[model samples]
Target chain A: DAGITQSPRHKVTETGTPVTLRCHQTENHRYMYWYRQDPGHGLRLIHYSYGVKDTDKGEVSDGYSVSRSKTEDFLLTLESATSSQTSVYFCATTGESNQPQHFGDGTRLSIL
Target chain B: AQRVTQPEKLLSVFKGAPVELKCNYSYSGSPELFWYVQYSRQRLQLLLRHISRESIKGFTADLNKGETSFHLKKPFAQEEDSAMYYCALGDTPLVFGKGTRLSVIA
Candidate 1:
């Protein structure tokens, strides 16, 4: 129930196309993260940003790229969308290192 | 590396019955464990953390370092308690288990 918002709550696109999912926050938190949720896999981090222009890959970052140009915005871009990438993507934000993360409602993406 | 294991994929208990969801982890250094829950049509949220050590919604989780387990328990389950629960470890970036879906029947 934080101020985090993930755009395009539901999206459907064809494979091999480029896609970008946007996460915007109003809390001005210092950390933002992108995670994908799939059956049998609780939630896997794709990328995270500590600050503006500072980002790092996570356990499952092979087909995903991210950018954080501002404190409140983190972008996840898939250069070429694949069917395997179709899943519910969530964005979370935290203010401190050990604080609980506040998650967005999530974006449900589908690739056909 | 930190890894959390949730043995059960699904758990079913009748209302007012005791409930326990098992969770075990593997980590060398000290760990900060947590239990996150997601109700139907709701986003994932923190239910309890080892650091806090406080029960939430009649649920409690004890961190057993010797056993490397943090099991969530409740004396009396409620119908609303039916949801998906995830056990996670770490602070900055958490490592989560596959999750266990609890079904509390009335």
Candidate 2:
């Protein structure tokens, strides 16, 4: 519990709709990351932000986008949602490299 | 490319039995391995890191670079120990394994 919070703990939406997930951190960590958890795939990184306004793609960044306009907030957006995008999403943050990451409760999104 | 591999998808052990979750990684650089656990309805939390070499909640994992393995071990499993465990490598953006679901039966 490193003061990480993810908005929309649960969401249900339809395909082709727009969806955005928010991750807010109180620790003011410089690094933030978004990941998706699937049954057979475990956790796959979607995107990450090393600092405000600086972001990078991860292993599974396709069809997903992220922005960190502020130091305390990182947003993950899906321009057009798909059934394949339905999964439990987790947000993590760390102060420095080689440090253990603190994770948020998670957001469970379902796309129909 | 760095990759973590968890061989078992599910494992069952009776309470008080010894438990071991196998994890192997493929990395050429100096590896920073970690074990994370997620209880039902709870967020994933760090259990232990190879660099620290400390045991948390009766769990210990040793990094064997020669074998490219970092397996989590607990001498006596408890019912509460049942949970989903993930082995991860790297620091900036960890590469996690598929995860292993441990079920400790009474």
Give the top-scoring candidate (lDDT): 2
Where does candidate 2 chain A have its weakest 10-residue lDDT segment?
A93-102
TM-score of each: 0.96, 0.97
Deviation from native of the Cα of residue B69 in model 1, angstroms: 1.0
A1-112 per-residue lDDT for model 2 (tens digits): 9899999999999999999999999999999999999998889999999999999999999999999999999999999999999999999999985678899999999999
Across B23-98, the per-residue lDDT of candidate 2 in tens digits comes to 9999989999999999997899999999999989999999999999999999999999999999999756778899
Candidate 2 positional error at A9, Å: 0.6
TM-score of predicted model 2? 0.97
Model 1 alpha-carbon drift over 4 Å, by segment:
none
- lDDT against the true structure, each candidate: 0.92, 0.94
Screening candidate 2 with a backbone cut-off below 3 angstroms (N, C-alpha, C), the clashing residue pairs are none
TM-score of chain B of 1: 0.97
Residue pairs with clashing backbones, model 1: none
